[model samples]
Target: MTLVNNPSRTARAGVPRQARAGRPPRLSGRRLAPYLFILPAVVLFAVFKLYPIGWSFVLSLFKTVGGVDTFVGGENYSRLLQDPLFWTALKNTAIILVVQVPVMLALATGLAVAFDSTLLKGRSVFRLGFFLPMVTGLVAYGIVFSVLLNEEHGLVNWALSLVGVDHVPWLTDPLWAKVSLGIALTWHYTGYNAVILLARLQTIPRELYDAASVDGAGAWGAFRHVTLPGLRPAILLTTVLSTIGTLQIFDEPYVLTRGGPDNATLTIGVYLYQNAFVFFDFGYASAIAYALAVLIGILGLIQFRVLGDKK
Candidate 1:
């Protein structure tokens, strides 16, 4: 018998030499399905989010006059530096950030602790009630608050009068307007923060608390030693989020106070809205927007450094 080796016969009967040699196989439709599935989302994000962001930066470099855009380099940003209204708006936002965030977070932390307590009853009902404010429409809540906080005929003032307390000017005086805005903001967002903190609280090991109890730590001591340490990350997360939201506050101040009482409540976001929509200064508005973004970025970095885990 003659022994014959045929490459063609082997090729027809077995895997290709390249595949057998460990070369990667061509990707089939099944392998490419995920990318195809996400293609529409990628395209939409580019069109809606990425494009606007890029164009807004470009728009900031050009001054819009009489419906025509003229390149002005960094003049808009320079003008922002000189703009007193912008400074005032920044100041107001700082006040809110300083006052509102801590108060809201403190309240949220307390509420979270309360909700996490085994002694508390109707936990689900309370949680849902608290969370309902978060779902309420911004405009609707703002409108409701405007009515409730009105100085002359509002329910709050009426109650104050009945208690023989003077009717506080909730939204009229400059200082009082900021207070009212803070109150509204805290009421609207504290629940949301509480819910987040509660979720974080639930993840903490119950053994730690039991150990602390065995060590004769009281409720306050246990919370100080164990609960707070466990809650650090969640508190930091809430603080950063609250900072961003407070800095960019618009709808609440806009609808409730219209950044009124001599621009006392004018936040950066409201200022940006005014520049873009009210005055039609698209270039300056874009500049303000970017400046606000930079401010947020700086503050976020600072917060992470100050509050993030050391290790």
Candidate 2:
């Protein structure tokens, strides 16, 4: 056989023949490469995001003492349902969310439009002035504001007095406390949000504005028809982010008023901190934290829905 067989025939004879499959599988080398590149990110997410979420969920369900946990099922959640402080926190948070977020977003939109239009001279300086408060520490700002809004000796009261106005107990009064915090928070973050929306605003085509102008659209008309629509996504994003931030507000209330006068500024975050850190009821705190997370998540979903419906 060795002497008689041709080269191809001899090679075929030496190899073991198997049953033929339908087709040889195609290896998606290019399609698969992206997944391989993203594997590190996936791993990190599993380790950090997923793992922590699981731990928090577990923590929310159990009572812990000296590092040992006793499973209590839905007890934590039930307790939250019955808690009046939780409702008060919810109401305060809701008020801030309703008022502060929209006002801040509106102001930010206006500032962004102004900055983007080149109407404002010394744009960099204006932006810096607006953004400076954001870089200032929250606790530091809270402390500063506490002093500035002090009922008796504060600059704000003195300034009001100069205009023949009465003293406002900004920290001690419930409504005034909300107002003061809202003002401070708005001042601190509106610029940051504006900068974000401004970046988005820049991405909108200048040609659209030019075309609108050609069609006899004035500034307001162009803005309403083109600029506003263009800003919907940015608006939705900022709204969701601001809602979450407001809902979980803590440091400002904590440092400025400590959830006074009589828990007027008692936000969910403050309440949670009080439960966990002050009273050392870790389970209840975890429950409140998770509830706030759920509330924020729901609000985000609602915003997304509204945005979609508009589309």
Each model's number of backbone clashes? Answer: 0, 0
Off by over 4 Å in 1: 1-26
The 0-to-1 C-alpha lDDT of every candidate, in the order given, reads: 0.93, 0.89
**Candidate 2 Cα errors over 4 Å, as ranges:** 1-49, 64-68, 309-311
Provide the RMSD of all predictions against the true structure, rounded to 1 decimal: 3.6, 5.7
| Top candidate, metric lDDT | 1
Question: Model 2, 1-311: lDDT tens per residue?
Answer: 36675887776674444413345545479978999999999999999999987887888899976777899999999998899999999998898899988999999999999888776899999888888999999999999999999999999999999999999999989889999989889988999999989989999999999999999999899999999989988888888889888988999989988988888888888999999898888888888888888888888898899874453
- Mind sharing the TM-score for model 2? 0.84
Task: Determine the C-alpha RMSD for candidate 2 after optimal superposition of all C-alphas.
Answer: 5.7
User: Model 1, 1-311: lDDT tens per residue?
Assistant: 99899987777567755677798668789989999999999999999999999999999999977789999999999999899999999999999998888999999999999998889999899899988999999999999999999999899999999989998998999999988998898889999999999999999999999999999999999999998999999999999999999888899999988999889988899999999999999999999999999999999999999999989
